[model samples]
Target: EAYAKALRGRTSDHPVALPHPDVTSQDPLSKGLGLMERMAEGFALAMDDDFNSREAIAKVLGGVREATRLLD
Candidate 1:
């Protein structure tokens, strides 16, 4: 919610908000998964300069899958 409030003008409201750090996927349905995918892709590209952290890519893929599953 804090982030949403901060970006209210710049970005439209997201479907969900991260209230608890421990909780995962505040996105309702698969709404925010696109953001996750974009982040993962960007991270993969950014980390490619270091060592192409495959683990990070895997984690992001897992998150995407998890979020998608929530919609079902």
Candidate 2:
């Protein structure tokens, strides 16, 4: 989008394809953790070389799945 804007060409806005985070044990749905913030943090971590620690991201079984998709 930035590139197109800079070039003065048409910029199409496409919705980002992303998955939902894990739902906690206490909540049937997600009780919520600043997901957008976590996603941004996850992307930052996903970009770098090492991903040894998943403790923060993987708190439960569903979290493990979420991490798998996020990192994949």
Candidate 3:
């Protein structure tokens, strides 16, 4: 809930912010980092499901697969 609320206020690019002051968009590593963060976010969202039943587990597993698709 808190996480979703926080994301609700961000621009699409906000999550891609650099970790270091010296980093720039031109850095190849930045692209990889952005993808990694997005993938991690997907996994987090999957695990954050409020449901407590079996359906929730299915949602989580689906989310995990969706997030990992970034690796392909």
Candidate order by decreasing TM-score:
1, 3, 2
After superposing candidate 1 on the true structure, give the runs of residues whose Cα lies further than 4 Å from its correct spot: 1-18, 22-52
Give the lDDT of residue 20 in candidate 1: 31
After superposition on all CA atoms, what RMSD does each candidate show versus the true structure? Answer: 8.0, 11.4, 12.7
Better of 1 and 3 by lDDT: 1
Estimate the TM-score of every prediction: 0.35, 0.24, 0.35
Model 2, 1-72: lDDT tens per residue? Answer: 333444464346654332244434333223233343455566556545375356434434444555565445
lDDT by candidate, in order shown: 0.57, 0.44, 0.50
Worst 10 residues of 3 by lDDT: 16-25
Model 3, runs deviating above 4 Å: 1-26, 50-72
